[model samples]
Target: MPPANGAWAWLAPGNSWGWSNAGLISDGEESLLVDTLYDLELTDEMLAKMRDAEPLANNIDTLVNTHANGDHCHGNELVCGAEIIASSASAAEMAELPPEAMAAIVAMAPDMGEMGRYFLDCFGQFKFEGITFTPPTKTFEGELHLQVGDKPVELIEVGPAHTRGDILVHSPKDRVVYTGDILFIEGTPIIWEGPVNNWTEACRRIEAMDVDHIVPGHGPITDKHGVAAVRQYLEFVHEQARQRYDAGMSAFDAAKDIELAEYSAWSDPERIAVNVDSLYREFRGEQAASDVFELFARMAALAGYDVATP
Candidate 1:
């Protein structure tokens, strides 16, 4: 659903794993797209809807990827002739896990045991095959200001939190902010990258903005109240994880032991496994990246699936 004014939001149905939201900000013949969908088919459908609702969408002049996540950018190939944009960190991260890698993972799912089944459960619906990874043609750091005809659009970099380079698309004229994966309204946010403080600060920054509609990367369209909820979740998780870390608990055990309280209702509680692992690494001052497979295996365990015999 779209806000009463300003930009229009295109949300995918449920608040599950790969279902993300996109946006369109248009002024006369010029238009800017917030993000794309999970795959070619999904993106094409979104584009068709946008074109029907706003004629300017047929000629989208700018395509701004809020982050490097595959769900937010895998459909870039459908938006032809648009100047694709992303943060420099996001562009680099995009290369780290391309479409081919995802396809390969899906193919190998059958033999990988419980973690494989969990991966399929999260992403099996999306068609990742034959996706030509379309990287951003233009990249920036900090902030970049652009325009959609007469409307002023601001791209604010608030990352090294969710990912290496996450961004928020603020359209001042329209009073809307398209937060990439920064605000996963009502969904449990996983920390692929974190200082935890940075993510909380990003939430505060959004609250301070003069915007009415807040378009999240996943889940429903919301406002500052929704932003506050996500912030509260982050703060709560950080505090809980910190306490467990101080007690010399392993990250996996800490995730299991920590009470979610009110946030237990959120989708994908298994994500707490990843969040605790990240916090534990932070506490240890470990700069090494966690293995993606290992993280998924932990999440699978948390989800009550038996780990494959080694």
Candidate 2:
């Protein structure tokens, strides 16, 4: 559904894995797409919806990827004709893991033990094959201003939090902000890049905006209240992770030991493992990258997989 100003949010179901949201700003003749979905089929479905809602969307004039995550940008190939824009950091990160990686992971899922089964459960619905990595044609550093027909849109880079190049797409005319992964609604947000503080600050920035509708990269459409929810979760996890860090606990141990309490009900609660790992690295002033397989194993353990006995 579109807000009063022709800004539409394509929301996927909550509590489901790889279910992300996309946004569209139409001016009756041209449409600007905020982000694409995880797979070709999903993207096609979204585009079809947009076309039905606003014929202008049939000719997407511009596309902005809020971040580098495949769930947000994997369908770029489907919109290859549009002029793609992203932060330079995100453009760089986009090439680091292409669709081929997703294909390989799916191909090996059958033999990955419990982790494999869990991986399939999360992503098995998406088709990873035949996706071509299409990097952004243009990149910016801090801010960019453009127009979707007559509606002015501002792009603000707020990353090294959700991902290296996370951004917020704000349309002042529409009073909507498309927060790519920077706000994950009711879901437990995964921190691939964080000092935790940065993520929290990003939420505050969104709160500072004069917007009525917020389209999150994942989950339902929301407002500042949604931003606050994500901020609270980040702060809660940061404090918990810090307590464990002070006790010299391993990231995995801290993740396992921390009590989720109010956040336990969020979707993908095992993402606490990734959040804790990122927080531990921040606490130690170490590099933020970790082996993906090891992180998944840790998450699997926290989610009830016992690798030692399996």
Candidate 3:
């Protein structure tokens, strides 16, 4: 839904994982794309929708990737002409996992046994090939200001939480804030990076802002309440993980034992495994350096996936 002003969002509905949300802010002549989608086909569809709204969207002058995650920046090759921008940290993280990495994952899925099957189920449709890694040509640290013609847009870096560098696109003129994975509605948020406190504070920052429509990285168009809901989930999970840590339980055991009946209705409940593991590390004042594949393997096990016999 397009906001009250020139702000617009492309929300991919349902609980299908990796179906992230993107936004556009156009003022007739110039436009800014909040983020791209997970793959070539998805990004093409989103660009088509945006073009339908305004032809200016077809030639977006600036592309702001909220974070380095492939889902947010993978389709950047499609808009190579635009000057891409991101937080300095995000630009660094962008290089950490390239399109080839995704391609490798897809190829290895079959051999991964049950875990591989679940991996394909979550991310098989994405066409990772032909995705050129277009790192942000311009980067900023904390805040940056820009304009979609006359409407003002503010980019706020709020990370070392969702990822090494997550950001929010705030349209003060439209009273809208496009949070890139900082808030997820109707879905469990995987904590790829966290101090837990940084994430909760990020949510609180949004709560204090005088904004109307809140555009989350995934799920439906929301408001301040949606932001609060995500924050509450994170807080609850943090406490649960903390108790398990105090008892010296493994991340997998703690995740399996913790009851998320309250968030049971949310999609991708297996993400609790990742969230608990992340919070446990944070609780112990440890470095945020968990192995990605190891985390996924643990999640697959917790989700009742049976490993194939050798």
Candidate 4:
């Protein structure tokens, strides 16, 4: 059975990633949506499904942007008159990234711009339009409890790891936790902002939770084991990156040098660069903000092309 609380999850696949999905949730009265997909068409389908599941989007009172990633919140503008909510950190990070940037990135195709086109085609599959920039109607620190009709949900802050404002949504009564990007179930876990250890710890915390159902920000619905696998990946990558960084290896060299043979089967093998980049910054302390561009460049090397930038 799908999640109750009037929620619906659609598995959106193909394009760049082999598997990617989006979700919707409602609470009878005012619905709360989590992680809208890339564009209006996809988002419209998700909304229609949500309405089919429960009549909420027609009058959604609140919306939450788990984090600022495009796949998660690109279709936000479609939720007309809905009060948007995200951690201050998430809002800030998202504001810095305009949908135009993504549109621009995806504008390229193979050949003169093969890599850029690949990224654009993959990440660009989700249509983004009419998405006006609306900051969160409400922001909170630590934890926030919300009532969507009678459903009680917890908005948790577990970031400075995935992104500055990464959050997980927990519904204790429902025994479900929507782990934004904290857990990527069967997909490549990337750390745009990380202390890899913090991410490792977040996984531990997830594992320790009373909840049994987990909805990863990406990939299919999963369980604690799925959570554990992601945790293990981060731990392994952290150790691996640290080894190369200590040897004074550049982030690119580390991406190439580290084989990750143990995780050879993992999807998006290129994300090793993201893990390396995040770990490198952690190793550098306050003086560093990982160069996301450089990391993307290295990632593209391993991935065969740059799919995120145009």
lDDT (CA) per prediction: 0.91, 0.87, 0.88, 0.73
Stronger candidate by lDDT (3 vs 4) = 3
lDDT of 4 at 136: 71
Q: Runs in model 3 with CA error above 4 Å?
A: 308-310
Query: Candidate 4: global Cα-lDDT?
Result: 0.73
Instruction: Give one digit per residue, the lDDT tens place, for model 2 in 1-310.
Output: 7865688988886545678899999874778998998899999999998889888888889999999999889998888589999999999999999998999999999998888987888888899999988889999999999888788899999888988989999999999999999888788899998867878998999999998888888888888888999999999998888888998888888887988998888888999988998888888898749888888887777778765311
Q: Report the backbone clash tally of model 1.
A: 0
Ranking by lDDT: 1, 3, 2, 4
The candidate, 1 or 4, that scores higher on TM-score is 1
Ranking by TM-score: 1, 2, 3, 4
Using TM-score as the measure, which candidate wins? Answer: 1
**TM-score of each model, paired residue for residue:** 0.98, 0.97, 0.96, 0.89
The residue ranges of model 4 lying beyond 4 angstroms of the native Cα positions read: 14-20, 108-112, 286-291, 305-310
Clashing pairs in 2: none
What are the per-residue Cα lDDT tens digits for candidate 4 across 1-310? 2664465566655323423465556665677777677766777777887676666668777778788777777777778788788888888888787777766555543343545554654465554445555567777767889987777888888886788888888777677788878877667888888777778888998898888678887777888899989998888888888899999998767877887876767667788877777778778885366665555556666777634431
Best model per lDDT: 1
Model 2, poorest ten-residue lDDT window? 301-310
- Positional deviation of residue 88's Cα in model 2 after best superposition, in angstroms: 0.3
Candidate 1 structure lDDT: 0.91
| Distance from true location, Cα of 155 in model 1, Å | 0.2
